[model samples]
Target: MVTSVAPRVESLSSSGIQSIPKEYVRTQEELTSITNIFEEEKKAEGPQVPTIDLKDIDSEDKLVREKSREELKEAAVEWGVMHLVNHGIDDDLLERVKKAGEAFFNLPLEEKEKYANDQESGKIAGYGSKLANNASGQLEWEDYFFHLIFPEDKRDMSIWPKSPSDYIKATSEYAKLLRGLATKILSILSLGLGLDEGRLEKEVGGMEELLLQMKINYYPKCPQPELALGVEAHTDVSALTFILHNMVPGLQLFYQGKWVTAKCVPNSIIMHVGDTIEILSNGKYKSILHRGLVNKEKVRISWAVFCEPPKEKIILKPLPEVVSEAEPAIFPPRTFAQHIQHKLFRKTQDALVSK
Candidate 1:
């Protein structure tokens, strides 16, 4: 099991090197002193992505299903993101998950560290502050915990939170619901690509190896919100990501050559394509760049569930049906593991350069 480290405050000037704790409530002075290298000059007007009601797709009428498919396809190609409504997940379950996240994050730094990320072993399924290496001493102004929920054998219970009493139960139920939804979404996307609904799922090893990972992000209020970023600009590495964020507006997506703010709709979940999906669709779909902004007064919490193929080695490439003489494959065939590793390395390099 990975050991947790307590947050320690050292008396250092703004210009001097300082070590920020993995999870701690930041003081007003400390929040103001942190440099924001990701400040933006202007924000976009509104959400560029469209919203789709899943109920439309579930309708008994064939015409309704077709229309919903068309709308989803368009959103996938144009924005690579969308909001999902009537997704069938219980509101109470969502509330439970949120409460559990809050409980865990509210724990003392030392307690939280008990499940620190095992970086030495390249395991990220635990509490951590940054995903990429901070060789240049620059980091995002957020704390997060990552864990795998599917493929039960692959889960490390040691890293799972024991406190919050119902944290495990709540997360487990949430994961079950998310898995079913993801499978349905993937089936719809396959139909949108002019293939059998189950084709894409089968190619990725179906339910057996289906990888479902969850990330809970906590962004504390920053005194100088304009000068700091909760998370840097980047695209997800999974096939698809479903996110539930509170009303605090901070999520932004890069669209039409500008950064547009993603507005939160009550009880709605945001869904977005990831790099793997882009590759599977042969450039027909997109994986957009997004980031989290900080606020001066409100703390933000978000739960993101990432869906991908099973762990067994599988080559990821655009389906043949989606590619032809008119549209050739744009990406080379690569194993899923290889693709993820390459993306992580590139992100680390980019982060280092930015610092």
Candidate 2:
């Protein structure tokens, strides 16, 4: 759907342009509303996004494990996002993932473009900057590398990066670990929702049919950071998203009427509830709106893996366990492919988003 062939944001930022092109400049009204809300909440000792320790989530002690699940449920219902610590992912492996991405982005422009994504042809895998598909035709100040990592056999290696000798190796290992972690979290959430531990997973398509896709976002330093957004505000379409970043904070969430900046916790992954989960929970849980902000002095990079159901097979809606005569299902059933189509072509407003 992206038709623009504009230069990559990384190239534009490095070119030392005195001001961003008009297309990238957001309207003054838009900037003021976002800027003013963030400033108003800046001085308050606002609530921080909940940080959950996963070390005891599976403890042999029954009481301890129950407490951990309760904490996880509370965070999910209240914030729709949380910081995960002691999540069993190796520190060294996390560093390797980060280095792999940095190496690829550091490649020569001509070399990097070799794997450019052909969005024009309906292919989303590979590297490229998605330009101006919005009403204003404004470009986001970010470039990204996206590819499928799970359903391992479905991986199209041709579009994957080959220059970073260990890119595939590191990312593959990371994806494997994240799959297990996400499954564990989903089980806990299901139990908290009063359903069988495996109910949610089954509804989303069991491991054999689950889909995991990774997007490595690169936000370059902008000369006029306030005039442009690193990424627009939108909720993910998947069930869950696990994010790893390089210790630079730029992620923001719309919470309790204010934009809250998520502070990064070293070695901790940020987890987000996506639209599928909200619909499946029948409004018991939420998928919040989030956006990224650009920095004037530093580049910010993040790796986000979206865990979802097989695109066409799973019909997402409220699970029978969550919906009762007293609590009706607010969302209608729809396959993931249909959901994506509506969002992509602007067929209609997505029902999954409450606002």
User: How many residue pairs clash in all the candidates, one count each?
Assistant: 2, 0
Compose the digit string of candidate 1's lDDT tens values, residues 102-153: 8998888779878878655777778876633534444577888899987677
Best model number under lDDT: 2
TM-score of 1: 0.85
| Cα distance off (Å), candidate 1, residue 159 | 2.2
- Tell me the lDDT of model 1 at 295: 65
Cα lDDT of candidate 2 equals 0.85
Across residues 130-226, which tens digit of lDDT does each residue of candidate 2 receive?
A: 8556555667889999999987887898888997999999998998899899889899989989989988888888788888999999998888877
TM agreement with the true structure for every prediction: 0.85, 0.93
State candidate 2's TM-score.
0.93
